[model samples]
Target: MTVAAISWSAANARRMERQFLLNPAKPGQAGPGEVVDAMLAAHAQVMSAAELSVGLRMDGATRLDVRDALWGEEPSLVKTYGPRGTIHFLPVSELPMWTGALSAVPGGPSPFKAGDRLTPSQTDEIVGAIGEALDGACLTIDELSDEVVARTGPWAGDLVLPAFQGMWPRWRSVMHVAGHRGVLCFAPNRGRKVTYTRPSAAGSEEPPLSAEVAAGRLVRRFLYAYGPATSPEFAKWAAAPARWAGEVFASLASAGEIEAVEMEGVPSSWVVAGDTEFPAEPVRGVRLLPYFDAYVIASHPRERLFPGRAYERALAGGQAGNFPVLLVDGIVAGVWHQRRSGRRITVTVEPLGSLNAGQERELEGQAERVGEVLEGWAELVVGPVAVGAHA
Candidate 1:
């Protein structure tokens, strides 16, 4: 089919608006769950960063509000192993879609050797035990380990899987898979230690959609938020095989769920069949994004999002989200860092080029907004950042 073409700048502008970076929800009007739904999933490898990621997208949201949404009596979000097998904050309403989509990803071989890895039968037993153990109860890793070992066997608890500084129990390797299977999820932190529980506790146990249905939903969602993108980019973002992603995209296109698009200087891409809309002007604003922000991580044509100096300053190798980025009009322009003391937070920005006085003031306001999301007073400083990526 003949595809319509779009400029990279136009694509970026549309994506920024979809991601809530261009025009976020009004203060006190929207909740963290809405932001989570927009981004597909908010990375939670760094919990504080995840909170800011969701909070910043909602004009008046605070860290406490994010916390409440996750752990309150009627929680609206579930912290779990999301895409790429990493911790993420998923909207509770979409748990079934997330579980089905994530669990269907083709897994590679285990890193552990024969002796260290759990046998297929053992793995099944452990997965079952995890669901049973976590049902209606929150347990720390150690506590869960003990329960799993007792329910399964000593081999389930054997310390053989090599980890940083130490070896992990054999069953721990399947923990993420269990989460994808909808049997495990994170609970509120117990003191300083993280705890796990079953997602069933947060809501009724709804069955996950079939793999095909789930994959279709996920691909359309990705396109809605970051489209005019390619199968390979979606593969990278979802950690699914490139071939598998291509097949999924082809199926969606064939079914008329999506249509191909031509991006000048970019390979073939697609978007929701009738969803082609771009802003009259490029997105304009200075925004501060926390570490691993979904926009920086998921947006495609890497060079387009992190143009020129931002490629060197904000990214580690070709990967994004290692450094908190400063975006000028939807494109990365610099990097930034924050240091908090008591109720005050210091924001230090390192822009690639000189900013006009108005831009500088806008940046200061962006920094102050960052502090507000974190529930602190922010002081902005425009200068060099001393730290390196992911520091």
Candidate 2:
């Protein structure tokens, strides 16, 4: 395969993340209006608050207008989903199916594993209290925990008081299960409330799609958006169990939606829908990617998406802290830091290697674009700092 094919595959793999992929115009190039148009054209219905910020920067969109345009008018433009139990934006139209697919698997474990302070009965009591307290009102986690304690008194004490640590994971799982069963649905937190609330009852219990069917749909979507991915990469991205992911791929292969490809000296299969095209030639530009950007996280085997040496430098010592990144010529060249002071924002970049004059200019331009999105004047600083320097 040509270098363009490899790059396209990598880009698509990143796009499969959907929420994490931000389609912004290159810096100093696309205007704010054009950026918003590009975002709309990408079929993004809802965007995460952070993802939206990055999107605006990438698209040269005015920072002030970002939230209002995408989420203010349509409150459902951004929300959360997934097994890791983190926040993500899903297009309103796709929420139901996505949630169904995500909630199919019971969350991994609760803090109250085998040995903990609370007994089984006590745990059940705590769960019941939370359910009762949140019956009609939306509450922040803190508020809910407080109410549970007030209501159950001694039992809540036994379950949450001492450390109140282990109870959180279990509670999250319970709430997830409740949401899956239609006992509750997520709504905007607003202020004073928590991350979600009980949404309307309509379309709540449409009967969850089977896991296999859901997996199939998820795989197809990933391949379409981030095709030419290895099974492990697909498994990681889908957050599906390995065996289940394997089975899903098998089913898709049987249906002829994917085909095998060779990478390095090994034979691997990736989704293929005939031929594809590269975005453009000489893909030279700078992009500021947000934390957990799909481009950085997708591709089960990360080596497929980034240079092995660069990955090591980016994630020094194995502690993958969320650091903003600087991408040059379609590859991650270094990491960036953004610090805000009053009306001014300072952007510091630590390059992994020497940058050409063109790359430097592109990086500065991207920083300016980020300033526009953030609605703050920005200063760009570049250096060859060590990987763990800032950390």
- Tens-place lDDT digits, model 2, residues 1-391: 3222344444433442232233445665543333322222221212332543445444445644544433354333333344344444444444455556676543444555455445546656665666566566666777766766776664443443234455343344355444443334444456655444443321232455676676566666666555566777676665557776777688787887666554443456465545344333444456666455544555434554456556777654532324556666656667877777976888888887788888778778777766766777889988654334332
What tens digits encode model 1's per-residue C-alpha lDDT throughout 1-391? Answer: 6456788889888888877887778865567887898898999999889999998888777899899999998888899999989999999889989889988888877777877777778878999999999999999999999999999989888888888899888899999989998999999888999999999896637889899999999999999988888999999999999999999999998899998888875558888989888877888778899999999999988988888888988899989999999888888999999999998999999999888888898898889888998889999988999999884
The per-prediction CA RMSD against the true structure, in angstroms, equals 1.3, 6.1
Cα lDDT for residue 282, candidate 1: 80
List per-prediction Cα lDDT, in the order shown: 0.89, 0.53
The candidate maximizing TM-score is 1
**TM-scores for all candidates?**
0.97, 0.72
Q: After superposition, how far is residue 7 of candidate 1 from its true place, in Å?
A: 1.0
List residue ranges in candidate 2 displaced over 4 A: 1-49, 52-54, 62-66, 69-71, 106-111, 115-137, 146-170, 173-195, 199-210, 264-266, 272-282, 316-321, 384-391
